[model samples]
Target chain A: MSKAIITRNLTKRFGDFIATNAITFDVEQGEIFGFLGANGAGKTTAMRMLCGLLKPSSGEATVAGFNIFTQTEQVKRRIGYMSQKFSLYEDLTVKENIRFYGGIYGLSHQQIKSKTEELLGKLQLQQEAGQLVSSLPLGWKQKLSFSIAVLHNPSIVFLDEPTGGVDPITRRQFWDLIYEAADRGVTIFVTTHYMDEAEYCNRISIMVDGKIKALDTPAKLKEQYQAASMNDVFLQLARAKPGENNSSS
Target chain B: MQPIVIENVHKRFGDVKALHDISFSVEQGELFGLIGPDGAGKSTLFRILATLLLADQGSAFVNGLHVVKDYKAIRRQVGYMPGRFSLYQDLTIEENLNFFATIFKTSVEENYDLIKDIYEQIAPFKGRPAGKLSGGMKQKLALCCALVHKPAVLFLDEPTTGVDPVSRKEFWEMLQRLRQKGIPILVSTPYMDEAMLCDRVALIQKGEIMQINTPGNIVKSYGKKIWAMRADNMFRLIRDLRAFEGTDSCFAFGEYLHVTLHVPVEKVQAYLTPLQHGNLVIKPAQPGIEDAFMQLMQEQNETV
Candidate 1:
C-alpha cells in the first residue's frame, strides 16, 4: 500500500522545551489511524505540523506525496481538517455552509451543486438543506461538518475528537460515515478521548509526553501490554507523574 | 432516609421541554449516575436538585429538604460542580480553593482530609494561576474546590466530559473512593462506559428516564444473543445486515458490526452466505451497557 503520510524525526520545540520530540511514523493510504494521548501530550503539536499549519523545528515529512517543508501549500490542499469545537456556521443554512466549504476547497460551481445534493441525501438532511445549522440537532450538525470536510475528496481527513459529548446512537452513525470515507480510499487520522473510539481504528498510536509510547493495532497492544482495554493501556503508559518518564529521544 | 429525591419533575425552557416527568431517588451513601447524551436534561435536572433552579411542576429534595423551600439548607449540604470548570481561572489554585472554602464559611483546613488526596496533587502548583494548569490538573483543582466544603452530598455534572482518558480513569477512581466514604454522590456523564462504574444509573433521553438499574443487570436484561460480525467492506456490511429480514438490529461496534439475529447463528450465516465474497466473519458477542442503552433508545424512538 502507498503511504499517505510519512515523517522522520518530527520535532517541534518552544524555546528550551520540545512540544513534539523527534516522533516518527508512517500512515498508509485508506487507513484509519487513531492518535491517542493524554492532554498536553504533543498530539496537537504533531498534528499541526503534519497539516502544514505549524512549521516543524526539525523534521522531514511528506503528506499526500508532497514534502511538508517544500510543498506546504500542496500538502494543505490534499487534506481536510475538522475540530470538535467548530460546528458549522450556526447562522448559515445547511446548503449555504456546504457551498461555503466547497468554495473554500476550490471546487467549481457545477461540482459544488452536485456535491451539495449528494451530501443532503447521504446525511438524510434533504428537509434540512435550507434550515439554519443551529436549528438542527447536535448530531446533525456534527455529521454535516464531517461531510463538508471531505466534500472536496481530499486524500486524508483529520478529525479532532469528533464524537465528544454526542449520544451513543449518533456516535455509532458517525463511525459508519468514517468507515464509508475509509472505504472510498481516504485516510482518516483521528484523536479521541473515548477509548472505545480508539478500538475502532485499524491501528492506534499512544503518545506520552512528546513520544509515541506504543503504536500498534488495538488487539496487539492489549495483548502486549496485558491490558483489558485501550483505557488500561493508556493508563499504564500515562499514569506516571507528569514528566517523570521523559526519556531523551 | 433518601439523600436525594426528585418527584414528578417537569421543567421547560420557553418552547423546549428541557425535562419531562423525571422522578428518581438516591439513597444515602449510594453512588448514583444520571447517564445520557447531550440535550438529555441532565443539566437541568442537576441544577434543580442542586438548588440552582426550580422544577416547574414537581418537587426536588436534597437531604430530605425541599429544593425551593430549603434552597439555602440544600446549598449548604451539597457540593456542586457544574459541567464547565466553575473555578476562578484568574486566581491561583490556592486562592480559588480558599475562596470556595470561604463561601461555605469553612476554611480549607477544616475539610483538608476530604480533599487532601486531590488537592495535594495540585498543591505543588498552588501559586499557579488556575487557568495555567493543564486540563487534568484543572479538573483536580476543581474537584478539590467542590469537596472543600465537605457537604453531605455531592453533585458533579458531566465532570469528565472533556477530560483525558487517563485523568478520567483517575477521576472515576476518586469517585469510587468518595463513594466508600458514604457521601451519596450524584453524577452525570455522557460516556456509557462510565455508567458501569456507578452503583446504579438512570439512562435519560429527551428529559425522560429510559431505564434505571445496575449496569450489570441492564446488560443481563438484554434478551438478544448478539453476534460480532465483520467483513472486508464494513460500510456495505452494515447496510446489508440492516436490510436482512432475520436481523433484529445491527450497529457498528469498533471494527466489527454487532448484529442481534432473530434467527439461529447458522441461519444468519446462511443469509450472509451470498456475501461471502467479502469474507464475512461471525461470532457470538457479549452485550455491554452501551448495547443495552442503544436497544432501549431504539425502542423509545420506535414507540414515539
Candidate 2:
C-alpha cells in the first residue's frame, strides 16, 4: 500500500526544551493509525508538525505526498482535522455549518449542495438540518462534525479526542462512521485517551516523554507486553520512568 | 441514616426534565458510582445532593441534614467537586487549598493527614498558579482542596472524564484510599469501565435510573448470551451480522463485535461462511457493564 504519512526523525524544540524528539513512523493508506500518549507526552506537538500547522525545528516528513516545509498549503488541503473542543459553529444551523465548511474547503456551489444532501441523508439529520448546531445532542453533533470533516474527501482525517465524553452507544456509533471512512481508504490519524478505542486502530504508537516508546498492532503489543488488554499495555508503557528503556524496541 | 440519601428527586429546566425521580443512597465509607453519559442527570443530581441546586420535587439529605432545610449544614459537611474545575485560577495551588481550608474553618495542617498523599504530588508546584497546572495536576489540586476540610461525604463529578488512562488509574487508587479513611464517596463518570471499580453503580440515562447494583451483580444479570465475532473485514462483518435474521444486537467492543443472538452460534457461523469473511472467529463472550447498560437503555427506549 502507498504511504499516507511518513516521518523520519521528526523533532520540535522550544528554547531549551524539546517537545517532540526524533520520532519516526509511517501510516499506510486506508490504515487506522492511533497516536497514544499522556497529556504532556508531545503527541500534540508531533501531530501539529505532521499537519503542517507548526514547522518542525528539524527532520523530514510528508503528509499526502506533500513536504511539510515547502508544500504546507497543499498538505492542508489534502487533510481533514477535527477535535472534541472545536468542530462546528454553534450559532449556525446544521446545513449552514456544512455549507460553511464546504465553502472553506473550496468546494463549488454544485458540489456543496450535493455534499450537504448526502451528509444529511447519511447522518439521518434531515429533520435536524434547520436546527442550530448547539441544539443537537452531543452524539449527533459529534457525528455531524465528523461528516463535515470528511466532506471534501480528504485522503487522511485527523481526529483529536473526538469521542471524549459521549455515551457508550454513541461512542460505538462514532466508531462505525470511522470504520466507514477507513473502508473508503481515508487514513485515520487519531488520538484518544480511551484505551478501548486503542484496540480499534489497525496499528498504534505509544509516545512517552517525547519519544516513540512502542509501536505495533494491538494484538502484538498485548502479546509482547504480556498484557490482557490495550489498557494494560498503555499503563506499562506510560508508567515507565523517563529515560528508562523498558520497551524492547 | 445513610451518609447520602436521594429520594424521588426531580429537576426541570423549562421544557427539559433534567432529572426524573432519581433515588439512591450511599452507605458510610462506600464508593458509589453514578454511571452514565453526559446530560444523563449525573451532574444535576450531584448539585441537588450538594445543596447547590434545589430539586423540583422529592428530597435529599447529606449526613442526615436535609438538602433544602439544612442547606448550610449540608454545605459544611459535604465536599463537592463540580464537573468543571471550579477553583481560583489566578491563585497559586497553595493559595487555593489554603482558601478552601480557611472557608471550612480548618487549616491545611489540621487536615494534612486527609490530603497528604494527593497534596504531596502537586506540592512541588505549590507556587504555580492553578491555571498553569496540567490536566492531571489540576485534578490532583482540586481533589486536595476538596478534602482539606475533611467533610463527612465526598462528591466528585466526572473526575476522570478527559484524563488519560494512566492518570485515571492513579486517581481511582486515591479514591480507594480515601474510602478506607471512612468518607463515603458519590462519584460520577461517563466511562463504563470505571464503573467496575466502585462498590456499586447506578446505571442512569436520560435523567432516570435504569438499575442499581454491585458491578458484578449487574453483569451477572445481563441474562443473555453474548458472543464475540470478528473477521478480516470488520466493517463488512458488522454490517452483515446486523443484517442477519438471528442477530439481536451487535456493537463493537475492542477487536470483536459483542453480539447478542436469538439463534444458536452455529447458525451465525453458517450464515457468515458464505459471505466470504476470511479468518472468521466467533466465540461465547462474557457480558460487561457496558453491554448491560446498552441492554437496559434499549429496553427503556422500547418502553417509551
Candidate 3:
C-alpha cells in the first residue's frame, strides 16, 4: 500500500543538457505505470534514476522505499530492470540465460535451477529450454527477458520498450505476462513508444520536451485532451509546428 | 483485377510458423488495414504481398501479376515502407527520394507531383541528413521515398507507430489524398483507433485473422449493454463498481469506465445507488473498434 516510487523535483542532466527537468511523480505499489514520450523525452532518464543507474542533478527520488541519493544500492537490490533490447546471450540456451541472470541476482545454485524451471513453466518455454536463445522467436525472447528480470522476485520491475519490434500477437502475449506479474503484486514501471502498449498500463505519464505533459489513466488523459485515443492524447500535447526543434531540455 | 490477392498463404521462419492458411484480397483504390499487435503475421503477410519474401506454400498476385512469377512487375507497382526507418539515414532527404526514384528508372522531376505535397513540408530541410530529421519528418521522408516510384499498391507497416499523434493524423490525411488518386494502400497498425481510418481491416492475432470488417460494422456488431461512468475518484469508482452485481466488464474508456451490464439496464437502480452516492455520472456508451477487437479476442479464445 505504500508508494513504491516517489519523486520530488527529480531532475537529470548530462552536462548542461537537461534530460529530465524538475519533475515530480509517484508510482503506487502493485500498479502498472506507463512512462511515455517521444524518443528523447526523459522517460528513460527518470527510469535510470529510479533504477539507481543515474543520480538526479538537484532533486530526490525514493525507489522501492530507498532514498535514491543515499540508498541506491538497496534500491537496486529491490528492483529489476529490462532495457529496450534486453535479449539474453544468443549462444546460451534458455535455461542458461535464466541461470546467469539468477546468479547475478545472488540466488543459490539450487534456487536458480528451481526458478529456471518455474520461469520456463510460466512462459511455456520449458520444452525449448535447451535451445539457443537466438533460435527462439522474438516473442519468446521477450517473455524470457521479463522472466529473468522478475526471476529475482523484485518488488518493482522496469521494462523499457520490451516489445519494440515484435509482432502484435507476441506483444499481446508479452503483455499478458506483465499483467500476470502485476496480479502477483509486482509493481510494473514500463516505458514504450507504442501507444497501444501504453494503454495496457494502469496509468500513463506522458513526457514532452523533457516535461511531464499528461499523467493519469489513459482514459482520463484522453478525455482531458478531448482526443479519441491515446494516440490523440499524445498528439494534442506533442503537436509542435514544423521548424520548432526541441532544445533537448 | 484486384490490386492484391492472397490464396491459402502459409509462411514459416525456421521451425516457427509465422502465418497459417491466411487468405484475403484487397481491391483497387481501397485503404485496407492490417490491425494487430506484435507477432500477428502482419509483417509476414506484408512481405509476401510485397514479393520481398517467398511463401512456403501459397499464391499471390498484385495488380493481376503473380508475386512469384512476375516479381519484377509486382516490384514496379508496389510502394513498400517498412515499419522501421529503412531508408539510408546518412543520405539527405532529397538524396533518398532521388535514389528510390532512380531505382525505378525514373527521375525526381518525373514523379515530383507524387511526392510534392509531402516533400513541400520538408523542402527547406531536403539537404539535411535523413537521420537528423525528427520522427515526423522522417515519416514524411519515408512516405516520399516510397511514393517517388508512383506505385499502384502502397504497403506501409505500422507507418505511424513511433511518430507523434499530429503526424499520425497528417499521415492518414495524406493517404486519403493518395486514395483519391486511386492508389490501393495497405497499412498496418497496433493502435486500434487507426482501424477506423481504413475502409476495411483484418483484426489479426497469432498468425490468423480474427475479423475482416469495416470498422463501423465491427463496432456495431458488439451488441452489448455498455455504459460509461466517471467521478472525482474514477479509479476507486472503477474498483467499487466492478464488485457491483450487474457489472460484467468494466474497462477504462475515454472519460469514463465503460461498464458492460450482466443484466438489463432498467434494473440499474440496484447498481447506481452506490455509484450515484459516490458522486459519479453514468451514461450509456457506444463501443469502439478496440472493444470489438477485445470481445472478438475473448470469443476466439473461448472457442479455441
Top-DockQ candidate index? 1
Q: Identify the runs in model 2 with alpha carbons over 4 angstroms from their true place.
A: A240-249
By lDDT rank, best first, the candidates go 2, 1, 3
Interface RMSD of 1: 4.6
Q: Candidate 1 lDDT, tens digit per residue, A59-172?
A: 899999988888889999999999888758999999999999999999999999999999999999999889999887778888999999999999999999899888899998
For the candidates in turn, chain A alone yields TM-scores of: 0.96, 0.96, 0.95
Error of 3 at A168 (Å): 7.9
Q: What are the runs in model 1 whose C-alpha is more than 4 Å off?
A: A242-249, B231-233, B277-280
State how far residue B44 of model 1 sits from its true place (Å). Answer: 1.1
Residue B168 of candidate 2: its Cα lDDT? 89
Model 2 residue B5 CA deviation (Å) reads 1.1
Residue range B1-304, candidate 1, lDDT tens digits: 8999989999998878899998899998999999999889999998998878878898988898999988988888888889988888799999999999999999999989999888767787788888777777877788888889898999999999877877888889999989888899999999999999999999998888999999899999998888998887667788888888989888887656788877888987777787763778898899999999899999999998
Docking class of 2: medium
How well does chain B match by TM-score in each candidate? 0.96, 0.98, 0.94
RMSD of 3: 4.6
Candidate 3 residues lying further than 4 Å off, grouped into runs, are A1-18, A26-32, A54-62, A65-75, A89-94, A113-144, A162-187, A193-204, A214-233, A244-249, B223-285, B298-304
Error at A6, model 3, angstroms: 4.9
Question: Which model scores highest in lDDT?
Answer: 2
Candidate number with the higher DockQ (1 or 3): 1
